[model samples]
Target: MDRFEVLSVFFGHKTAASVVAAHSHPYWQLEIVTHGGLRCAFAGDGFALEAGDMLLVPPECEHGFVYDKPGVSWITIRFERAEDGESRWGGVIRGRPFTDRLVSSFKIAIPGSADKPYEKAFVGGFLDALLHYIRSDEFRQPADSPGALLGQITDMVLARGGRAVTVSELAEELSYTRSHLSKKFRAIAGESLKAYIDRLRVQKAEELLKYREDSISEIAADLGFGDLFSFSRFVKKHTGASPRELKGK
Candidate 1:
């Protein structure tokens, strides 16, 4: 089975003076606070997370924060969902309640120096183990729960292969009114449906640019962009790179 792909990982420290403005990313983020505390604002809500607290911020959520105390330290892993929709983390993590055990498990899995020869494999295994613990009986939910619905919607968006999808279309297929679906989605997923779709499309474009020999124009058309210029703007907005630059990377 495919698993979540770790795009980057690092340990960071912040002083009381540190501040980050509202920003969003196109990859899932797992952050574990190991020292001091942080004040985070997301989805119009605020949270004070301290030592042993773990926060999972889904893609496209507008979040910002500041250190609440001196010497705030944390471990962050940015990851992308598997193209095959088989990532264990994706299904287990959406709207799931955090637990002390889960926090401890993540702390234990923290990676060593990035310079280590086995760093990548070690971090990947660590994430797999952490997800394993989270998927245990204590954290698992019924198939009909809100978390499951969120997971289902995520899978559908990913499976579209960058095809444009609207909230109304998804709601109609799910037998829900658009307004109700939008509210519930934001409440559970921590981001708007449109933002999620945009990020997913850019992610798909990145994959195609890296792995396929198709011309940029072909990719733009395939992703439903009106023209190359439109696709260029969309990619730059989300990824901060043009098609040529991304392909070079």
Candidate 2:
């Protein structure tokens, strides 16, 4: 049977100048902007998404965002294919409007966490409805070749786990010049390669700190920091908090 499993849902808010550098997930992502505006770039093309704009990204498609206004808020739902290995939907759908009634229904019906069977069923039904609406229209956007390559690069970086990866190394592995890869990545991701890596490392460190009981020193080493001081400095630079402060939270 063709079915979808809801993996996670997150409500996100970002202030002005915030950036989510290019990355892809193994599951499909549906992002709806509820407030303010942002630019979403994928497959080498950019879409200016404003309030109420919805973006449906296929699995493993490289995408990122840059907030264009203050207090940008969005709802993201991640789901994966189940049972039948084929996806029920194809291509990307952008800027579609959900009915006011549907939006209100979502607010009232959605569970805070999908721990119960009913909650899971409700979310799955919502996704089915949303996907049906998206597919009713014949809008299909083709993928950009360069954007696909950038996605591969992103995947490589994520595969490195706690190890550090340099642009030079990625370029060599991909058989492209460092300058070329850097330029293409910046154009699509709206951030430099180094900044993207630093942001990713900080994000990983935050996850480990929150979920895992690893010591700060151990976490630092896992993230490829030379020492505790360096790791603390990096965290402070990116998050404005020390590792101890974050871990305590």
Candidate 2 local lDDT, 1-249, one digit each (tens): 237788887778886577889998888888877788889887668888877667788878889988868889888888886644436353334442233345557657763556678777777888777766554432232224655555566567777774688989989988889999899889888889889887777888888888889899998898888999988998999999999999999
| TM-score, structure 1 vs. true | 0.45
For each candidate, C-alpha RMSD in Å?
18.2, 18.5
TM-score to native of every candidate shown? 0.45, 0.49
**Which regions of candidate 2 deviate over 4 angstroms?**
83-98, 137-249
**lDDT values, one for every candidate:** 0.74, 0.75
Off by over 4 Å in 1: 1-139
User: Which number leads on lDDT?
Assistant: 2
